[model samples]
Target: MKPVFFLREALRALKRNAIPSFAAMATVLVTVLVLGVFIPVVQATTGAANEVRGKVIADVYLKTDAQQKDVDRVERVLKSEPMIKSVEFISKDAAYKTERERNPKAYELLGSNPLPDTFRITPGNPDDIAKIKDALAPEAAGGGRTVIDPAIDEVRNREEDTNKILAVTGVVKITMALLAGLLGVASMLLIANTIRLSLYARRREVEVMKLVGATDWFIRWPFVLEGVIVGLVGGVLAIALLAVVKIAVVDPLAADFALIAAPDTIDFPLLIGLLLVAAVAVSSLGSGLSLRKFLRV
Candidate 1:
């Protein structure tokens, strides 16, 4: 059959069953709208969580009398570790200058620069902080304090603070992921049910066509086209609504909130395209599958 014939039949069916058609379209619209909003929210939240994780770092303080060679060796070892992302060395002079700038009166009483040279260690993953600290200062054979390198004075990673941040961020990410999965499933079911209802209303027509020797493809094309039409209209409407929200709400707030302005979030045009494709694909599949039982005649 010609494409025009299938499209005309689909249009005629939609007009004949306007209420069901409208209901299916409305279902698609709501699903698409929810998805459109949820995508950006998830991205922003994840980005914020990552920023917090990045703050979890380890500070390795060297002995005040440590030589340049010892400092170089420590830096080399840190850099060799697979779990360490970066190692930054700060001289005692630099540390003293920074502290004095923050509180000049506190430093005036000191006879000499008391701060030790420090190595700031950032881990590839926040959870690896304890390993990095342990690597630097493991327990001694007699259970006394010991350092992996004699030049190292102490290692601190603020374990309590790191654990808290990791726990909170982990829960947030897991919760968001689970919620997104659940929402996606619900959307699919809702759209599928709406399409099924439309198919149910036209079951008699399907049966009559089958009984009259109409090929399955011949019967399926019109219903699939009808679903495609509904999905296209619904998706376009949803995208327009999202665009208005982005312009009026998100864009205005982007200047004040780093989360909103972050470049890591999904691109708006790409997101819209994905939603449109999803809407059309789901509707057409739902229509085709829903017609299977009726086609058995």
Candidate 2:
């Protein structure tokens, strides 16, 4: 049979069973929308976590009365450690200046500069944070009271906060994946049912074709084409809706949430392509599965 014949038959079947066709398409639309929206958000969240994780560093605060020699000694020790990637010393005055710049009005209430001299230690990796901290702390590595670095009054690391963020991102990804799977299955079943109903409605036509010696493959092509059309249309609709949401809702909010450093990570073109491919696959599979019973003749 010619391609035109299959297209004509598929179009006629779609028109004859308008309700089921619409239902099937709607199911696909909802499934694709849910998948499209969350997948990008999850990706952006993960990217932000990675960016922060790369910059993870330890802050070593010094005693108020600590002098230049103390700073140099701590700096030398930090440089010697294999876990340490880089160290930058910040004087009390410089720290105070940064605070003032960050919140100009808040510092007006303070009588004197209370910020301490500090050394910011960037670790080779976030996992190496604990080792680097203990090495530079006042306590010796063996737990004896011997001070390893006298100038180090306290040590601070944001490893816990980073871990929590990563954990939450992981949970979000897993939840989205499960939800996408459920919706995908649901869409497939709905499409299959729609195709089954359409075929059943035209049982008489199929019987006539079988009597005239029409092969099963010839009988199946139109239904498969119909399924492909339904899927492609649904995917297109979902893509349009997602595009609107991205432009009106997501794009506008990205700037406002820039402080978290998570925006601009979602690749729109790639996402749309994947959604279209998934839609076609699910729809076609559903149609093929439903056609088995009707093809027995």
Candidate 3:
């Protein structure tokens, strides 16, 4: 059959079964909406977590009495280490300035600057943070008293912070995957059921066409096209709803939630397009599956 013939027949079927068609479209809308909203959120959260993870650094704080020369020597050695990606030296004055800028109120109660000079070491790999921290540990200078390297006081790896971020990201991903899978299965089953009902309403007509020598594909294309149309429409509606929520709810409250990563991580338009395509594909698949038993006629 020609394309126009298929289109007309699909439209006719849609008109004849408007209620079921609407039901299928509504199901698609809800399922796709759940998918569209959560997927981006999970992507953004993981991206932000990775960004912060990449910044994980081991801070080597120096004693107040340590000599500048010794500190410089330690920094040079740290830079040459294969496991360390980079090392930045922050002087005591700079550290104090940073603390003051970050929390001015806390400094007001103190009489003088108590911050120490430090070397910020970025590890070559996040998993190797502990190794890098151990390698940079201050050496025992002498007797049983065990004094550290002349220039070092303490080393803080921020291990707890890093682990927490990773753990949270992992949980978010697993939860999102489970939710997406459940909704996807529900959507497919609902679409299939609706398609079956629509097809059953016209089973007698299908039998007549089959007896009159109509090919299986020739009889199948219209129903399949009808389903595709329903799915595409539903997808479009879901996307519109998502856009509204983003603008009205998310965008407005974004400033209050500073921890959320930038939205640039995922391309909104591309994501929406993919969702629309998925909706159509699933709808087509559901329609084909539902028509299997009727095709035996």
For each candidate, the alpha-carbon lDDT, in order, equals 0.92, 0.78, 0.80
Top candidate, metric TM-score: 1
lDDT rank order: 1, 3, 2
What TM-score quantifies how close candidate 2 is to the native fold? 0.61
Better model by lDDT: candidate 1 vs candidate 3: 1
Superposed model 1: Cα runs more than 4 Å off: 140-145, 256-263
**Candidate 1: minimum summed lDDT over ten consecutive residues — where?**
255-264
The weakest ten consecutive residues by lDDT in model 2 span: 138-147
The deviation in Å at residue 181 for candidate 1 is 1.1
Task: State every prediction's TM-score relative to the real structure.
Answer: 0.92, 0.61, 0.67
2 or 3: which has the higher TM-score? 3
TM-score of 1: 0.92
Tens-digit lDDT track for model 1 on 240-259?
99999999999878866744
Tens-place lDDT per residue, model 2, 154-243, is: 888776785665466557657756876776677666656766776677777877788899988788888788888988999999999999
* Candidate 3 residue pairs that clash: none
lDDT per residue for candidate 3 within 254-289, as digits (tens), equals 767864556455677888998999999988878876
Write down the lDDT that model 1 would get: 0.92
RMSD of 1: 2.1
